[model samples]
Target: MNSQDETQIAVLRNLYAKQAHLIDTGQHEGWAQTFTADGEFHSPTYGEPAIGHDQLADISRRFSESAQQAGERHRHVIENIWVTECDGSSAQVRAYVMIVGTDIERKQARILRIVTNIDQLEKSADGWLIRHRKVEY
Candidate 1:
């Protein structure tokens, strides 16, 4: 790969890593920002789907609030990033994800989620961000 290709790849990776860290840090707003204005989070665990920025923010807010109440620690690991397109302006990213939530009171650790996301992204002046993410179990 050339230098420019390598740079675009790095930028995409940063987007994934940033959201993962934000999730662990309980920064749901930051997480929502990683998505486009019309981004969607399609997780069956939540029952109702969140579509659009404000809805996504509210949904994530509730999730974050619940996590805070539970006082559990979380870690979201993203791996196997496969970039189908990386021209910089837009790209497709596929990644494996495993989220673990450990209950402090129970002192237990368990796998929370094992899944993958086929993410459609757009590159803006600010950076690369997810335009849409189709999540599959």
Candidate 2:
């Protein structure tokens, strides 16, 4: 609507792109930093929700290891990002995330999973951080 609003949306979009790259490249710590210290991630695929920085980073590490052992590379494509609600300090966003996996030896890529992510975000001095994310497959 306004210039400020447009800027915020663009920043949020960039956040998603940054997160995807971090996780895909096995930058576990950096990916976890996209969230707040007490952030939570809930997903059926993970069985248990990962809370706090330590748990978040651990999950990323495990994910990276699994993919590496399988001789596969994964990519996260975040699309249709919508800032459903936004106040100055907080926002609710939704997006579709498609996880694509590539088998290095086979040179084949396939869609691993498609999930919808609903996220609660907070604006801090450092910028926007995800407070909580719920993923539905």
In order of appearance, the predictions have TM-scores of: 0.87, 0.97
lDDT accuracy of residue 82 in candidate 1 = 88
lDDT of each: 0.81, 0.93
Q: Which stretches of model 1 miss by more than 4 angstroms?
A: 69-71
The digit string of per-residue lDDT tens for model 2 on 1-137 reads 89988899999999999999999998999999999999999999888999998999987888788788879998899999999988878999999999888999999999889999999999999999999999998
TM-score of 2: 0.97
Question: After superposition on all CA atoms, what RMSD does each candidate show versus the true structure?
Answer: 1.9, 0.8
Ten residues in a row with the worst lDDT in model 2?
Answer: 61-70
Residue 4 in candidate 1 has what lDDT?
A: 92
TM-score of the candidate numbered 1?
0.87
Give the top-scoring candidate (lDDT): 2
